[model samples]
Target: MRALHIILFLFSFLFSGFFINGQEQLTKHATDSIEELVQKSRKLLADFNIKESLDHTTKVIKYAHEINSNVDISRGHYFMACNYEVIQDFSNSEFHYNEALKYAELAKDSLWIIRSLNGLGNVYSEGYKNLEKGTFYYNKSLEIVEKSNIKTEKLGPILNLGWTYIDEEKYDLAYPYLLEAQKLAQELEEIGRIVAINDIKYLLGRYYAGKNEIEKANQLFNEVIKAVESLEIISVLTDTYKAKSEAFQKVGNTDSAFYSIKKYLFYRDKLLDEEKIKQVEIAKANFSLDDFQRQLDATKKEKEYLAKIARSNMVINIISISLVLLLAGIFFFYRGYQSKKKLSAVLKEKNEELQEAKTEAEKLTNIKSQFISTVSHELRTPLYGVVGITTLLLEEQDIQEKHKKLLNSLKFSGDYLLDLINKVLKISKIESNTEKLTKTPTNLIELSRNLLHSFEYQAKSKSNELILDIQKELPGVLSVDSLKLSEVLINLIGNSTKFTENGKIWLRIKILSLEKDEITIRYEVEDNGVGIPEDKKEFVFEKFSQVGREFNKSEGTGLGLSIVKNLLEMMDSEIHLDSKEGRGTKFHFDLTLEIIDEKGENELNPENSGINQKFRRILVAEDNKINQIVTKNLLDLIGYECTIVENGFNALQMVQKEDFDLILMDLNMPYLNGVEATKRIREFDQTTPIIALTASELSEVKEECMSIGMNDIINKPLDKNDLRNIISKNLLG
Candidate 1:
């Protein structure tokens, strides 16, 4: 989340950078209509309307392009790439960011270019696959801006450098850059820059607070609230409130602290609401509200005609009856008049009803879409807990090879399940046009490693390089989401891997300009297997589109690039392609990211200390030999005694039969699963613990196990650390 903030802040800086320096003439003010769309997109990104946000940003970029407005175009890509970074589509982000840089450079717009470079750095540092290169690009950008005489650009680089230091945990090193940025921000009289200054101050304050420097922290907090007060913009209100809340929290003012958090949420949502209202108004103004009434009036006229026909028909009928005696020999006119009147009345009523139904149906469809997207977001947290725990367990060194393999397999399956769930969620959101996006600080290096671990086998089978050319100078953590952005990379990588019979795939990163925020990340999945034609590039992003090729149809659902396009679009990023009809293929795309301040370069490395840890006697309760062997091996490595029993019933007998520190039970035992066995074990030995092993999808299944006196439940594909961590946190810790 801190990383996510860095990315967002970087974007803000990049955009602001465009406002300063020699490139000031590059359309700071976009056209009203496109700007209106851009505003809606900002709101949508806030609301997690990833699809809608992308749709709007795409329009903004197109319009910017149409007008040849370099600044607006740069801003368009800068904002769009944020969401793409969140969704893990580094390639697309790289493409659009590069395009934005091109525009900035074409106009000789250093400010916008600086922002684009910063953004590119963020993508590599946080969103894409290169961190070392990310830092390099970010530094290069800083150097360029330092000489530009643009205080804003200079301030941005200072802030970014400070963050890189902080991420590296060089607190002393981070302070000076931060101090400089704060001073520059004050000099510029910019509320946005001031808001950022307060954040750095607050973080610094937090460090001081952690060190018990209450006075210094309090002074910083004072400045934070002051900065908040100076910014009237509601968009800044969330941070203002949150900063105050944290400050109050540090001061031990609980009521004020809680109030601050509440206020933060309120203002955060309020800003979005205001944007939505404005969007509604703008959309409304685009069309005359009176037009519906005009349609109603036309319908009314038709109804009046029908009524007049009825009246005439009734008169005709009466006249026909009166004249029936005279015209009985020759009249079918009365019958025809009666039929025409009924037909006209029926047709008018049916048409009106049909239109009403269509309107109602559209509304319901929208509601359903919103509900699904909302629910999917809610589901992510719990899934994270399950997957996270499983992953941590696989890292335990004390575990034996057999159990380790089992844990590894389980982890793979769990990841696969998570992917499936995410795919379903994303597809649902996309189909309904209601996908949500959230940006946070992400670790590009760690994320890329995980991607390799997750898909290496699949790649290896095809004999592909699955290459990553990472940069060294990028911010250690840039604000983005690893999950979504990884999704993009995975899609592109998958596309390359699937198409290439036996070829190498590449993801390349570069910094286009240090003077601007544009950091260009190039993803070229060059495959010796096959290539795409230049003509197909434009239409490839269309939903479910597959370039018309005989080999392509058998490869995939064809939504990979479409989803990629949508993901990038949501982030206010653009995509480009260069592919030949033959000579193999190289696919590439770029985006302009908003370069944010880096506090430090962080190293993510977990500890492994088995010798210091102690394991006691454990009672093994499993109905199957295979599971028992897996458990026993893991237990033995961790230096725990295990008495294996074939069934939960026997485990209970043994538990009542003897004393043990922990009991491992299978959920699907012959006589009873772990739940029942634990319940039985609890009859006399309530103090002894039990853990369940099952392949249940629901984490709530753990609750069921615990409800029956089990200590914890380990789902099938058990990780030793799910065992160790559970033991450690619940028992050892």
Candidate 2:
């Protein structure tokens, strides 16, 4: 039932030999001696001989410090922390865990550091009931495990996190973690990790019981009890019975609860017999007394050593005074010259190494960028066909109602996948410093109104009221990155709508300061919804972090707020949040922008103005068959006749053979790419419009498309409206 307690025993047995193996560089005899002490200490601890274990661990620490072995020192302190935790001395457990962490970091041992962090987490979570601090340490441990790809070491932190969430009665939050732990436990079971298997089974039983799934919970509990009984894991047996009793009580099964409680009491008493209890008490008293005596003895020895050093230094200094006078400036100059020459040579060598490293790093970065671009194109190509087909199907008027519902769901999923892909690529670009701000003339009030309009369907679905408030004194237009600003607002507003139901959400814009050339405007998105907890505020902006995942599990991929933070920072602004639980949340930020034109045009334009229905011939150049079908169908929907070509080379031939109003050229095509084909076409026909259709990132190809005489570019997994608008605008020009 308690993962921390169960994992503590496993940690001892698994890591007992870690320090011994790490000290292989020492003398064989010394290593053998230390190894024996470590093994004996662990055995005594396992056997419940607390005093004997402490004595052996103390000796190990002394020997380790004398030999200056940080690995051994950390091991000793970690074991001491475990023993204290077993005895419920959380203060001492916390102190020793910290000390162990310090030495583990000094030794550069990641495994020991993770162990120390988990130990501290257990002290806070299990002993003190401080879930916040406990969750922090557990997350830290998991972060290290993930970064290091230590598959074998990830189960502890994951189990502990699930256990903590269950303690908070947030069963929804605990479910995913417990399921992941169950998967990991099964993997470990393949390698014969019996303890982990039983621990996960027990924790999962508790989770099911908490969720009122009594039958499933009882089945899991029965299996765990059978396994732990066979293994003679008395502590686990006691904890399981206690949890089963509480679960039965929750369901008002008084007779079963009573039976379970009796079993729990029996096991608890068996695990801690009266004689064992007396011995543990006596051990605690003796440990305190011995600690005091050891401190006194150490103080005496330190004073005596310092006195000896003082006398030795006094005699050495008197001799050094005479020696210095005899040696004079020649020795000093020679030593200084040699030292500078060695230092300069070392610096030069280091600089050469740094240059080589920089070159290798740049090479790797380029490789990563190329890989991402290739993957994006490959994924988007297929996704475009799916999304396009789904859209076309949904537009059919004679479809069955049930099938229409299914199609809508399919469309939602396709759109979600496309959004996830775009966000991921956006993150990659930002992290690589390839994302740049393009400051364009923008209407502030109109942009805010349009962003709110975009979320109307979502808001209505949630039964939430959407409000936009803009100060009259604000300028009509400002020089800003409207694309990035829209992205940030869309994410924020979308989150508010997703988390709030039958509540009011507001997008407020205020002029903080107005100047002749620049104005500082504050933008706020506030919602009366389920707000974030205080402990989770700092992590809201972390990548892939979902604060209210338990409330809305399927809504987001947890990248929105992280993208918002990065984009705002790029624009030289910061986002701030204020919220309380069960009330509301508000996110605000301020940006100072240059006034482009005070009386800028703020006209609202319809997305799809009907284009002329004149007989116009269009050329479609694409390599994929599915894309060709989807594209041709789309153009057909818009009442345009299209000629299809298998590649850019074929498109060039077709264009030369006949006159066409526009050409939709796929960027990556066989025989000839869009860029090359566009160049060839420009040499002959300069009047016809050529539009680049790419599955690659638009930023990567936009400039090249323009340079190659392409009029515009559209990303794949494209929206139908975007396709229509681009085609219409290009044809008009």
Candidate 3:
């Protein structure tokens, strides 16, 4: 009896041990599966597959709940928050992130706790634009990181704090946090540290740009853009472009600003499209989950009915089958409804995107127009001094023959530069749809003669013969946009001059048709030079398109032919190109212009007769010393005495004290600008001819100059002949 009792005890103990081992194995497998799901969720989220990531996290959370594992639950909720945030469902994201934080604290997982805190910060700061709330969460994360001495993990919270301050435009407070993050990233050897460094650099660039330190800001922005592009970090690239655009706009660099904003929009649109795709996928996933739940509930009901009908009749079983089929039909109908709803939402979002893009495009156009005007003024200001000095040197009678030749060359180059600037501005105006044709009675014969005469120095330098061939039947006077016509002819002739050496170039006008009211005339510019290749012919008229740069020694901005094409088009004409490689090129265009009889035309040749040279004193208001010297020398050459003032205030003072025949006021001046001074001067003394001198586009300032009681306006680099003519006309009138 004693031996049998001992054997029973041993059997019972071995059976209990086996049961305990089996239970332990099952628990380990379940935990391993949850861990695997959490890892997959993280990867999918990082790849921007928000729906797939959420699905994986959902599975993880379900398994974690079954096992009652706090760590796994925390991880699942953290990833769920991230996916929600990506979809911009901030309320859900905030709830999930809080849940994650609570579970992480329960699990005593510091890494998850920090991540959850940062996630909350991003939700508040970026999505909601609530900087104060965002900063609080970021600081909480930072506090924990500092206490734990986790250097690798601290970079994120620090960077987040800096970003919050920058968003608030509080760069002074942002700098320290950004600097600390940069230093920490530099010390770390983590794989993600490079990305962290780039983030810090981008924030620092924003800080400097806000301070209006453009050069420094641009340098940092360039660096960040290059690195992020290589890393394929699109989000950072978009933000960087937006910041860069704002920086350029602040400094009135309209071109750069426009370019940056375009890039910003492109990337932003790309992101939007990707996000839309994700949203659709998420919607499908939601429908799938709902379908699964309904099917699961139906299965439970069917099983309960089967058990209940086992003891009942066949009629009850048939009724249960009918109910199951009815539920399945309802599920299909619900799915169809969901799909249509999702499609409608997507279409509405796309329409909104298009409207936004259109508005941005219009804004960019306005920016481009402003940029062109600003650049024209800035460029012409310095060019005025260059051209004026060169002209003055050329007029000196005692200049050596060699120096005279050099001066002529210098003058030619200066003139070429001015033409190039004008061409660029013209292209901008044409593209902006601002250019218009203004017709007046013009002498075609004199206009053609002057156009040829202007290119004489250029033709001589290239050993090219310039020929003017006008049909005898062509009318001498016609109503046309002389400025536009002149520009077109100048560009064509200039293009021929640039390519042809030791060749004959002709500017020809043939009367295609003659009528009582108008005449159709075909104009041609033919040159024997390095003709464009057949493949390049089509591209020759493109802006900034150049050909034969390797062989041709001539240098140009490649805008001549394009300007010709645009101007001709504006005049309701088309430019045709004919060329053979290594032979010659001919460009022709036709225009129908109104005939103006010579009997009705009146001409005034202003006489410098009325002014007494000694008594006619001109007061010149100029801030730049070089410009002042140039203006004074030109006036002296014109045989007039002038008093110079450094600024508009001084000019006002001089005008009040002394008597002057005219005041040459430079529009841009120190202390007081020409416009304000003219306003003040007109308040007291209104009779003196205040000829506004400017290096800006004449049309931009002309009306204001005229409205401010100024009698006339003169564009600068002070053309000797124009200066003499304008001064004589104003003084005589």
lDDT per residue for candidate 1 within 197-284, as digits (tens), equals 6667766765565555766876776676666666544544555566565566666675665566556656654653574323322222
Relative to the true structure, candidate 1 reaches a TM of 0.35
User: For model 3, what is the alpha-carbon lDDT of residue 20?
Assistant: 37
| Candidate 1: segments with Cα more than 4 A from true spot | 1-422, 432-434, 513-525, 534-553, 589-602, 607-733
- Cα-based TM-score, every candidate: 0.35, 0.55, 0.52
Count residue pairs with overlapping backbones in model 1.
90
Checking candidate 2 for backbone clashes, the offending pairs are none
Each prediction's whole-model lDDT (CA)? 0.61, 0.77, 0.77
Q: Between the candidate structures 1 and 2, which one is better when assessed by TM-score?
A: 2
Model 2 ranges off by over 4 Å: 1-328, 345-359, 549-554, 598-610
Give the CA lDDT, 0 to 100, for residue 56 in model 3: 82
Q: Over the full model, what C-alpha lDDT does candidate 1 score relative to the true structure?
A: 0.61
lDDT of 2 at 353: 60
